[model samples]
Target: MPGTYPVPPGGGRGAGPATVPGDLLAELDRLLAPSVRSLRHSCAVDLTFGGSLAPGSRDAITIRHLDGHLGHTLRDLHVRAGYGLGGKVFSMGRPLVVRDYFNTAHIVHAYDRAVAPERIETVFAVPIRAGETVVGLLYLAQRDDVAIGDRIVARAVEHTRRIERDLAVGVEVRRRTAAYDEAATRDHRAVADARRDLDEAISLVGDPQARRRLREVSQRLHRITAGDDSAPQPAADGVLSARELDVLQLVATGAANGDIAAELGLRPNTVKAYLRSIARKLGATNRTHAVSLARESGLLP
Candidate 1:
């Protein structure tokens, strides 16, 4: 049975101002409001979001948002692990409900001070997970002691799952943005180093012809490094399929037909057929000539 646990003064309530971006929080409110409304119409009257803002802390889930009449009482409430109905759901990583909150032996009554004011008798709590980690808790409550049916529980789970997906996508977008910024910094440094090396080489070279050739190569490298540079367009006469391009890229690396077949999960005969078609498209007589044509056409780096 769940039992009441002590909450530190001014601790078991919503933390200070939100750390999440305002836009993200607004978007979350927009996306989640409909689900809460739907749940209210179909199952329960009150719905609250206890977001896991501080994963490292014992009292991680804070009641951040509410969507019903009981909002005034439940707002800013914090639920720690293994305490209260929401905490039990968070700690257990599952959904739970009680027909009568005060009488139920499955959950602690530590939250009665807040819940009693709201007159919430029946309540359901579901854990919202981003991948394997529980990131939030969703609660559905009502003023009566009516039992929450299985369909309502399933609906609550489904709604929470959608929130989990959005949270995961936000996390992935942040990770990719950071990675791209790091890569751009590295590229800038590499371009600077290459320019310095070219200047040094030009100074050391005595031959006029060699210096001119180096200058030409440097100009080409600069063009390649420009952000506006686009991939070479294929010939107007023929367009290669994606699979053919895959095979051609492998051929550009000097891979044999058998090696290409193994890498592409195709038979050697299929590899030969692709090569023949590529040769025809490029007007090349053999595989070696076909590779040369592809390089000249800027089809492969």
Candidate 2:
């Protein structure tokens, strides 16, 4: 919430994409692989691994990622909150270390079977957090019984900070994307409602000139709420049939063929036929183009 995401590959986080790709869990994993690779190469840590909290729960940490494991002993490891080193880190919201995991008295050995097969002696864990909540764990392990010095801990924390920033940005992106989608839905429904009300008013008007004026006002409303952004060209000569004009109105509102069909009591195939007819009359190449040209020729609002 405090900072902005650097523009990602496809667009900026503020640009409001539909959803954060792969959700929050996958965002954690995205940065984890590179961090693990860097940690294993940058320092003497024989093993580097991490896991995100399973979505919707903070009681368990599932490790699907690791580097330098000789066998599959630690693959997809599950560590509960407050039990193993990772659990202690999760529960305390801080880092934890053990010179000898098998002999450690500082934490319980709930994951002894998982670690015994790894033959790892020194184990270090750091909490990856978003705001005040611990969202994940990062682990550093070695085969020798040795103290994890402050130097390595600081480096590990540096990597953890990167992960923290990534998670925070991911959270913001998800929030923004959801808000954008909701606003779009709200706009869509509003256009439909306004169109319905305006059409009802036009039907009640008995005077021909007043009815025509009302129709022009309706077109103006459609243009404001629903027109495309693309530049327009002069419309072609042929006049669109009434049914084709009806189809164009819904198209301007960004309705799909199925929705347009249901709205006008036409079949899906009939909607498609009307769209083709509209395009031909307007000299347009596509749905958006048809709407733009119709607006250009004062055929649509």
Listed in order, each prediction's TM-score against the native is 0.56, 0.65
Q: Per-residue CA lDDT of candidate 2, range 194-250, in tens?
A: 978987887777664465455545555565566543324223344778888888999
lDDT of 2: 0.72
Model 1 has an lDDT value of 0.64
lDDT of 1 at 211: 51
Candidate whose lDDT is highest: 2
Best by TM-score: 2
Clashes of each: 1, 2
lDDT of 1 at 188: 68
lDDT tens digits, residue span 230-252, model 1: 43322344445788889998987
